[model samples]
Target: MLDYAKVIVTGSPISKSNFKLFNMHGRAILPYNSGKYHDRYAIYEQEIAFCARLQNPNIVLSQSLIAVLKVFYKSEKRHPDTNNITKSIFDGIEKSGLIVNDAQITRLIIEEFYDSKNPRFELELFGESRYNMKYEICTKKILDEPKEYGPPSNKKNSYLSKKSTFANTKEAAEDSKIHCSICNKVINAENSVTANNGKMRICKDCIKKLF
Candidate 1:
């Protein structure tokens, strides 16, 4: 009955208790709904078009870098503590203008794990290899999948624009008073703000001062 579901793993010996399960990277499937399954392939259709997302790309980038940093941190052993690793990764993310949260990072890691086999891929979050093609595919596949089960609708989801009616929100006015890290200048979210290291409290004009 699960049409879209693929045998992620095949040829594994199944007992009477378990059968027709797809296994990959040590994860097993219990036969979910076909549309609820990994039917993203049917939606995206094209590989290149599917791999693009603000959140997923940033996650892949962060994970890759974290891996490399872990190696060097380990080589030094006790010197670079976990805090140091986080700070270093945070700095790199800041420079690259990626604004993400710790929770988001956690989600990214978990996502990477569920769909992938390489523990190393998710573990090492700070390195060049994080940007590899394989990671890209994984992120794309995960992101493009339908958020809910059953056949996807042709209707588009309604979105509330961030810039829509800032007047309604109480904190909107005070947002302009925040200071920029690069230039130490005040900036507003609406006027010009660039987020790096998951903190958008800085202004783009001020960020330009970094150079």
Candidate 2:
């Protein structure tokens, strides 16, 4: 259950690296003024046309929004990952005041294509309704499966791993489980404290000294 809306807009999609978040003397910062940054700015500027045209004060009307974008490029050349262009799009919508914050977005889908004459992107936004968080499955088993998650970032899952909040980590760990190859036992993925490099797949209990 959601209130959905879609719009056709034109612009070159910018990749994620265009705007990097790095620590400057221990303070995190996002810089601009590169070529990709310029493209990102132009794309944001182009979206103003649609925002003005729609003139809907509440264009984004939910705490969680799932957007599906069909991005069209000029040619079929080497490109970044399909999901790389989404951050700027969400930032632009937020900049236009349509959305309070890009952090409100919980899901995204991006599809790319090549079209010279009509190079544009169609972005569809969906607002999650209340009670959408309560999920259910026919089976009683609660596996360590995430119903919805964003694109992999840094390969570390802060939400469900040991990095999660102390009080909540155990509960999250309860759902994520893996089987130990040597001991033939199932253990919570987080508690296993995996190195995750090669094909090693033994639980912490199985390891002798962790040397």
Best by TM-score: 2
Quality of model 1 by C-alpha lDDT: 0.33
lDDT of 2 by residue, 1-211 (tens): 3366666666555564554555757764454445554445454644744562375545555567776789898766644566767765666666666666778778766787988888767777677764233334486576675546444566667644645577577877764656776776887667565556845577877777555
How well is each residue in 1-211 modelled by candidate 1, as lDDT tens digits?
1111000111111121222356776664444346553443222212211222322343333232322222122121122223333432333333333333333243222221111221111122333333432344344634564545322233223223333445447466655467765666776657565567657556666556655
What C-alpha lDDT do the candidate models reach, one value each? Answer: 0.33, 0.63
RMSD of 1: 23.7
Q: Which residue pairs collide in model 2, if any?
A: 144-175
> Weakest 10 consecutive residues, lDDT, candidate 1?
1-10
Q: Against the true structure, whose lDDT is highest?
A: 2
Error of 1 at 48 (Å): 27
- Show the lowest summed lDDT stretch of 10 residues, model 2: 128-137
TM-score of each candidate structure, all chains considered together: 0.18, 0.47
Off by over 4 Å in 1: 1-69, 74-78, 99-103, 107-211
